[model samples]
Target chain A: MTGAEGKPAPGKEGAAVSGETETAATEVVAGAGAGAEADARVGVEAGAGAGGQAVAGAGAATGVRDRTAADTGAPDELWARLKAYEGRAATVACAGKDPVNAPMIRHWCEAMGDTNPAYEGPDAVAPPTMLQAWTMGGLSGHEGRTDAYDDLLTLLDEAGCTSVVATDCEQEYLRALRPGDEVVFDAVIESVSERKTTRLGTGYFVTTRMDVRVGADLAGTHRFRILKYAPAARRKPRPGRPRPVVNRDNTGFWEGVARHRLLIQRCTGCGTLRHPWLPGCNECGGLDWDTVEASGEGTVHSYVVMHHPPFPAFDPPYAVGLIELTEGVRMVSNVVGVPYDKVRIGLPVRLEFRRYEGAGTGEDPLVLPVFRATEGGA
Target chain B: MAVTADRPVTAAGAELPPLEIPITRTLIVSGAIASRDYQDVHHDAELARRKGSPDIFMNILTTNGLVGRYITDHFGPRAVLRRVAIRLGAPNYPGDTMVLRGTVEQVDGDTATVRVVGANAIGRHVTGTVTVTVPAGGA
Candidate 1:
């Protein structure tokens, strides 16, 4: 879902006809630099070679292999060659396989469970995140993809880094896309990180920046990053529980937990209590809020024992309760000090902190808050 | 601009009723296809397993769409989603049920920011915030 626009669809050729003019414009741009034209031509030939096609000319094949041999001879040389591709076009003026239209938008909404009227009816705009979606080539692949990107990947492949995984993508929306708007985008190889070893393997991170346009108007910018790695040896079983997603909005809560305090948010404007900390007070529409430490008291408002589709870091059949704190705010956490079946509604429980040691996997030691059932409760 | 008289009074701390979404193979495959994501890990079980995933998983676009829907569904059709920022956690595999819950975090005039989280049996699937504007007169 990241990196360049389309994944290479095997055996699909001759899709580049519509992008001929765009490709020509790219060559003109590449012509600005000395020898860039030849580099671009070599890139195309390398792309064809990587696609399982015999090089159109015997001389071209030898030229590609010679460069590959020279580059792969040294790790630093391979990296330098890869870095040289930075700032080159990954795709030039690639038109979206489909125009921003209703049916696709409707299908997307239905699948996402979205029913926003803004995405429907006569005056509708596509979801902003669908910026990359419109540019995808689906199973048939897309046109306008340049050989430079394929050439880069082929270099990595020859170096024994074959697997690829999308790491993340960030998008900025400038204009809302309406139905019937033609989508065209140009992508650049923005950056290539030095080889780094990760839990998955040793790999290089390639980041591409795409500018999506509607006609002449810039609509959005999407930056996608991927890791092209040589698969590491079999991974050790993941240790410990999945780390809780702690962001700025809820960092304070986690910080409080480290200090053995269970804090709840109180609206400054209307004094309403809220849990699972939020930035604003919903009742009084107040941006200002403060936290109050819970009194280490609560009852199980509801409970569920997880038994199936077991998750890592958790033993199955454990009770996860919606603990309603005495302060009138409820939060979910484990209910300990009792058998899973023994956890019942209205059971009195007190706040407790549990510590988990990091397993040397780049994870930090974690302190999480759990609730313990009090003696003779319910 | 719509008048404010008909709009329901929105306040901080208000919780949107939770919705349960069934994670089915059809939903996962169709969602990926609808979003034009041809990643085999999203629609092909065999390929997904080869890729180290237990099964085909939901793509980020679908996750974003669902988050947008969860907000507009509560705020009324007049709600305009200004932004949806989310990070995925547990993979949403088939047969699992993801429950989406939201809390209105802040309301400034007609615009309200809600913190949303979608969780399945494993744990949290997605968490983020959504900014939406509802016309004063609710649709």
Candidate 2:
């Protein structure tokens, strides 16, 4: 969360009573000149640390807290009343004649997982992928809020529903964010549905969409699925790492080998067989390599039945293993066709073709690699 | 509010010149949407408050977008992202305001590395490194 503090800090006493419901109708407008200015180059001492003190100063400026305490019957009505003014958008916008520069863009470059020089040098430009960060407005300025899915809880509570839990998250990326660009953001309530109610009071699934724009250009959109469930119901954990999605790039590799067949990569230079196609060959600096058929014979190199899914799309207590092909190539494959506990390391396994659901449908489906124990092999 | 710029090219132990970028709530939200992250913290303040977050936390994806733009804006349109590594430190809170600063640390061939930082109306919030490939000549 973006605050003076790295983590969620305690909210003011008044914020509790004011309640987000009351503040829901209020809209905050901010810009380059939103708040009291700070020395631009003070670094951390002034920005994150001084921000807390500035809030205190705002509280002291108007001795209204004392006045509100005497007039209102509420314990912290004055404090709550003060919260409206005390709270500001949690983000700090960057604006100037030279908004994008070495330092400015570098920070974002690091954030997006793109540190490629081809994108950030003076003559080089940023890739489209970097746009993901530029469009992000900032963190909610409110303190003590950090969970990614906590908003659903608050909305459910406001709706007289206390049982709410985040079920899953699915995300996709479009454009890349760069420095100096000004962005506009708005969260649109998409759809709220009461799925079903069981022993738990009510099972509701609320989905919200957010729209992003850059100077009137529709940048992208996001959808969130918030699931509200009863507190006592034992919620089944979501699948870990959804089955791997195979695209044109890796489809051939799976179909040929998984169907009791073998496919291998042969170097153009030496005509030696290679399992995986890398950028260059060890023998020759050539990037040339061809996909060829392989023999479906190999020994088990290493195996692991993961009880946990790394990507949240697959259930745990499953198995994954590395197999050494007769061609001296090693491949990572998911181990299946046997009980989880029955699978052992160094057991021989063979290629098996299995169907897996993908992000798309029909003409374009995701494919995965599956392996099974050889009849007499392991 | 006082607005001043010395036009200093570098700071103490800094590698490159300082840089700035105009930030916006729209930019943050759009970045989040583009990344397919619709967490209320980035969009709805009420939702953020209802949850435990003091406010919305800028998703790492959005931060990367803005930072990428910041560098490209300075380097021009031809630059490519070579390697970028960032450790998210402070959250860039909405309305907090930021002024990005950094120093060029190294220059090799068509690539250059920078140590960067983003500060708000209050102070510095993010710090990290960025390396980009420039044209044949240095920027």
- Chain A: TM-score in each candidate? 0.45, 0.34
Residue lDDT tens for model 2, B24-84: 5665565455454455556666665444334554544555455555665566555555544
Candidate 1 chain A: worst-modelled 10 consecutive residues by lDDT = A28-37
Clashing pairs in 1: A281-B12, A282-B11, A282-B12, A282-B13, A283-B12
Residue-level lDDT of model 2, residues A1-378, one tens digit each, is 112211111331111110111112111111111111221110110001100001112221110111111222324222232222222322212111232335545544443434456455555433544332333323332232223224434544444344332221122233444455554443333333323332222323333333334555544433323323222222334433354455655565666645645677677888777655565577777677777775556666887878654555566787677878777888887767676666676677776666654433233334455678774433
Q: Give the TM-score of candidate 2 (chain A).
A: 0.34
**i-RMS, every candidate?**
14.4, 14.0
**lDDT per residue as tens, model 1, A1-378:** 122443322331111112111121111110000010011110100101111111122121110111111122234556678877777678888888878999999888777766566787898888776777887766677656778877887787776566554433445567889999998887777666655443334445566667788877888766655545554554445577778899999998888988988888888889998987888988878988888989989999999999997887778999999999998989999999999989999999999999987765877888888999996443
Q: What docking grade does candidate 1 earn? A: incorrect
For all candidates in order, the CA lDDT equals 0.65, 0.43
The DockQ-based CAPRI class assigned to model 2 is incorrect
Positional deviation of residue A223's Cα in model 2 after best superposition, in angstroms: 24
